[model samples]
Target: MINYEEILNSSVVDIKPSGIRKFFDIAEQMENVISLGVGEPDFKTPWHIRQAGIDALEKSKTRYTSNRGLIELRREISSYYKRKLNLDYSPESEVLVTVGGSEAIDLAIRALINEGDEVIIPEPSFVCYVPIVKMAGGVPVIINTKAENEFRLTAEELKGAITEKTKMLILPFPNNPTGAIMEREDLEKIAEILKGTNIIILSDEIYSELTYGNSHTSIAQIGEMQERTVLISGFSKAYSMTGWRLGYILCPAPLCKQMTKIHQFCIMSSPTVSQYAAIEALKNGDDDIASMRAEYDVRRTYVVNEFRKMGLSVFEPKGAFYVFPCIKSSGMTSDEFCERLLKEKKVATVPGNAFGECGEGFIRVSYCNSLGNLKIALSKIKEFLKENKNG
Candidate 1:
């Protein structure tokens, strides 16, 4: 009766719901589902980190922090980058704590984009980039990174996607669904191409600590690229602090000043207890990260091998906790493959196209569950494939 459609924002209305959550919701209603659809870590928040939050509550440290966040937390973040990657930032000026890495990304996009500006994004990567770009009145320019290249955005791909209107390049390495990583050599080529451009690199390194075999590399670490890069990261994947909702951004002082204003108006401060916990995580969480990364490495190998054995052409993921295996052999679209697999076999997976159009024939399977669950899910998938072929 109330014409809510006419009153609602068209831009928001036009955006599609996340493809990743489609099968996940279906799996939730069904009985005995083995779902590998989400990227959440199955690990608990380390006790010391949890204790820090509890300690903060007991001490009544519940008031809002500065719009930029607690100075001590910012300092710990600064110390973290310095210790881990030999990167430096002035805690007083360049670091801003955020609600999560997702919010940090939103703040960066909103602060930087004006009407009709174009942002280059590589896919199949994270689902949030394109929608966020559009919400900021920025055009989404997608470059489909190929499986042959391990889904890394090649310099040629970046160079070709650039135009006079391009303002930002979202480098989502150690990427989400694909588990792709851009090595230092790979990033240097990208740096060379953008050397003289005004395009800002929004390097979403939320999965940085999860890389296996080789350590993660940020585009910000390449040459003088740091001056033009807005580095975003969080404790979700690394320290299993997802529900704690703490993340931070590091960039040049000028950009930091503007992004902080956006964060100030939209979110005056991040969670105080979470900030306290993050400080402890930054201080004493190396062993926790190492142990978690080691466990994920084992799972990654197992998942990749299992998918390959099922006769799916699986790209060996070097980062993140997912395996994007090509399911074209089943003669089904990604959506059909996942839907049928879910209904018939009781195992849930995300269709690759949820990440982008290029992900059409692939399926993203997260290996975040226990080895026992993974074995069960993988076996069910193998059975599904056999039935598909026989039918």
Candidate 2:
């Protein structure tokens, strides 16, 4: 034996595998399983966007792009942010494209954190933040966002978590499992708390275009907040370009320089074909976005109503394609509920604890599947709940 464990990096070894993947693996082995587990869009990439990638291929645009990505793509991203979020950036210096928002987040954290620095992460949010922070040799300080406050990170909770060593705060809004979004007023309050602090805000706004009722607000849009916020977003959610793996970061030039260095060594560039497709998406995908958002809105309403009718307590999700419904009423832990439901009903939902400890009593149900499939899954869940009433 080579003693692989002895040679492996201790920090990497200590990290647990993603909880979301556990149920997904079990679901995959079962035939005819209706999965509401993965946080991926079921929609195909709009034809125009696909054609753009094909067009790039036909033109022999297959070489590695500049380490910071294609200039035209960066410009388009800059314009897109300005048009959609009222934020501006110099594409040449302030924007850097990465494989996905996941990579952008990883690059930013790695570039910023020093050993033992504290990074504040609010949960039940995305699963990647804490692990990524720790991988950067930083301490992960968690602030549990409450369901009572609609899972938004309040100014008070944020202020209470901040300490002299706080180096960064991972802001995951239009959150993954919870589907909570912070409006402009909410950002203003957070901005007030972070006004004089050195803490960098890593704002993950991948679900910005998917918000219902109110428009999405970026903390970078708040006064003085832009200087400290690194905004990460991509075409994965809005343009259904997940497999294409295109994402970009918008930040101050100095931070962008450091992140680009890490990105340069780790990933020379995002896929050239994907960059071309993303350019097309930013330039002409408005109609596609609107249509998808409208359909998701319909699905969102249906899922929320179905969960409530089953007497499950669900906080109405205003954004993202997920609903975190409380499974506590069934007297089962989230893991138990998801496992039993998968085994008996053949409908797979993710345990909310996959997102954080605060998610223990809930189950994350992604509404990203087709209406027919969602209806089938919901019906099965209803039957499961009825059978396991005292579970």
lDDT of each residue in 322-353, candidate 1, tens digit only = 99999999999999999999999999899999
Runs in model 2 deviating more than 4 A are: none
- Report backbone clashes per prediction: 0, 0
Error of 2 at 229 (Å): 0.4
Error of 1 at 376 (Å): 0.7
Judge candidate 1 at residue 254 and give its lDDT. 97
Maximum-lDDT candidate: 1
lDDT of 2 by residue, 201-255 (tens): 9999999999999888899989999999999999899999999999989999999
lDDT of each: 0.93, 0.93
**What C-alpha RMSD separates each model from the true structure?**
0.9, 0.9
